[model samples]
Target: MSSCNSAPKRVGNKVKCNLSFFDTIRKRPIGPSGYQIGYDDLVALKLYSNFYHYEIDKLEHDSHYGGIFNLEFSLDGKLLVAACEGKQVLLFDAANQKQINSVDSAHQNCVNCVRFLNDKHFATCSDDTSIKIWDIRKLKSCLRTLHGHSNWVKNIEWSEKDNVMVTSAFDGSIYAWNLKSHSENNMLYDKVFLMNGLMRMKLTEDGSKMVIATTNGYMIIIHDLNLATLATDLRSFKPSLYRLMQISDQCYPVATIYNYLFSPTRKRNRIEFIDDFPNEAEVISSLQIHPHGWSVVSRNINGEENEEWTSVHDIQSRDPSDYENSFMYIEEDIPDEPEPEEPPNQRPTDLWLGYISLDEYSNHNRDPSQVSQNIWENNFQLPAMGILNSGLIGVNASYNAYFQQHPEQRNKVITNLPRMTHFIKEKNVGKGYIKELCFSSDGRIICSPFNRGVRLLAFNNQCQELSMCVPDNPQQLKTIVEMNDYHKDIVVSCKFSPTHYQLVSGCLGSEIKWYQPVV
Candidate 1:
């Protein structure tokens, strides 16, 4: 292992962190006894926190699990299921951390994901272009198998409010399955919508909206979906404009498309607040909304002021009244603190020197002998939204020296040269972009799958450090832990235990490891 206390990178006065300090607790192999766990191509982690540490458990193998693509737990948290690349579903007893059952050929091809409907009923999607609902009680058979997509089924989500399930596939089609009412011959799902490269889909807390992430870097937003009427309108649902369609008589689904850019050209330090939609000036890698659906947490595609690292932001409507109320309550409850006095020998802070343009100089009738210092002050004129700027300008040092040498020719040379007011961004940097990220239900802890490791971050919402109070500095998102190197290759997925203080991680090396914070 490398040094646990590895130094952070410094860019200007900012600190960039590549978290690499978490201690390994234990490793669980997923394949046969003779095979090496590190090279096993494990794609997902489905371990439960109920099992005590030091329990060495392995899922039984048939041929070999091509790779564990996704893992899920039953509702009661007693059973663990692993979706494998060999179209297999392995069931394990969570209490003892041992394999109890296995379905060798659950699907025609590799299984991509597994989600539980209830304790005994669970659903799995596969690359074979089908979805299967299985009951653990009847180990040999599947309850229902749904097929519609022409490409691989990538994701599946259950909506409890409507008693329906939504699935997305690689072919860009989305299907809705009405659990209460199936078609004549046990046809599980009815077609809902179609779009290209729909890789992932997540439903909001209230089931009013669905956020779809595509392979082509577009986020599809579907709003005002009436769950009560979804089953009835499945057949007549159409995507078009102007003339009233069949669903228009009832309720039409409102959809919007945002072209998400992974690399935006604006400066990172400037704040952009939007009231309706995201500004689209930053590369958004992953997006998660708060439980209330009022706030959005997004991971920027690239890390600024730091090398090979990224940052996250909490974007919400700015309510000045909320801050004022908070400030009033805090003032009434606490005593005032005294301000520290500055030392006599301390010099004033240095300010960036800027030159006024010829037009402004001519209008103001400025004196030539007096030196002007650039002083930026608080000029609050309402926060801007969806605005982009390059930032501060950079001029050639040799040009400045040449103007200084020839004082008489300075005005002539300055007049000829173009005046730049904004800064230009640097090209292509920050290779360590996050591919997948998940936050806990409470929004305190974030787990993201990075190259060969998992990044655990703690959000500093209170702004604890004094230096972090700087207005132009980066957000107070800190990497609290890093789990890496033990896995042979890239980590594909990670999840937090809903009921325990543990995290399960899955890697491409055919291994699933359960990690707990060292207390």
Candidate 2:
């Protein structure tokens, strides 16, 4: 009965509607609070919040035959030398990165250290417990082998003054040699200065003293030949007079003595004084090393310039009781003060403050103008502190962490170092540790070698890194290139060419890699 009224079923007042597919997919209109995002919109967001860009470039070059160990440049920046575990020293033309010469069989074992004394001569020490001096001009062994140490020679330093050389060994001994008369027969000039223990040695700039780092964590000072000798003769033919003789001929073995300068260290550090003949030794000063284990280089001031020569007076012999009432205050004659002149347009920028002193001015009878001038000149004495401050500021600006925190300050400091134009990381070369690093005199480029490759990094800061991974339709995009492959290996050492754009690196595998910078 209901089938007959199917048409009448819709008369119940309930209706159903269907929307088209196009209407469902249609985009909504822009609103004042909504954003319209394109590809650039996403990129802008990324750059503002997360993305970074670094550009880098790689150059292909000749590969090293073996792993690199150490690299260095000559003092004058003309030669780039590499010490390879292959028992050879390779010299390269710095300008072109071409192999100039090779010293085959330069060492019996791995060359651990190499240094050039001058443009013509250099020295190399090896694990074979020997050191060889070579003549760059002859490209042959210099016929002088420093062969005093019984164990591995760890380090060597040539004196800036004479032909004197100092070498330290793992055998806990140090030998000072005179290379001026260097021959096989005269291997060592002095009895190994027997540091009494194993130690590392560093000589001063003037070669007047040496600082010795002992295995016992003690730093000892060895005064140069400037000290006087103290001697007491115990044996005499007749003890007749029982004389208490003062031998003026016997010197005191030391000039002016002062307390040891204490510095922070990262280990248990102590300065010990030792006397060999008398078997006297004492710890003069002790200091704890800082947590960072960073070594500090300090310049010592000994009043060399302001020292006034005074006559020796027997003040101790004078009885204070005799002159207690009438003690006279003696004054030295003061020098005349010069007229003050106008400051130069460009004053010495790097002045050092040495010492400051204040003394009382006395005038028995003098011209008012002269006295005023003297007062003005002597009123305040400031040591070369200004020079020291300027030097320190320059150093801090270039290398200090504080400067790195403030970009503006860093830029200002960098402006002062007009020589440092750019810095770049070399890509693709050796596989070893960079033990030593040196730049050419001109500082146009840099060289480092590690493991199997010798890398030449550009000095210009124009290189950029390319991004290889960017998401499609992402909110932001960025690119980054890492040049870590160039230094993948343990690069114990690397050096730049002295005269050219060449770099050399040495590896533990006894091979040397020479690289030329591609312009």
- Which regions in candidate 2 have their CA more than 4 angstroms from the true location? 1-67, 182-184, 196-199, 208-483, 496-519
Task: Report the C-alpha lDDT of model 1 over 1-519, residue by residue, as the tens digit.
Answer: 122232212123222222222312122332254334422111111111111122244444433765556666676667778776666788876666567888988987767778888767889987666889888999798988887766567778888767788887755577788877878777666666654334566666676666655433234444445644444433322222101111122211111010011012211111121211122222333445445443344433322413222333323323434322211001112224234266644432222212122233224432322311100121112112221111111233443465466433322100001111111121122233223455554454566665566655544423122122223434444544455553455665565555555556655555555555332
The clash number for model 1 is 4
Residue 8 local lDDT, model 1: 19
TM-score of every model?
A: 0.53, 0.40
Q: How many residue pairs clash in each candidate?
A: 4, 59
Give residue 122's lDDT in candidate 2 (0 to 100).
Answer: 83
lDDT for residue 462 in candidate 1, whole number 0-100:
30
Best by TM-score: 1
Question: Which residue pairs clash within candidate 1?
Answer: 41-509, 41-510, 42-510, 391-423
What's the alpha carbon RMSD for model 2? Answer: 30.0
Residue-wise C-alpha lDDT for candidate 2, range 228-262, written one tens digit per residue: 11001111111111000111211110100111111
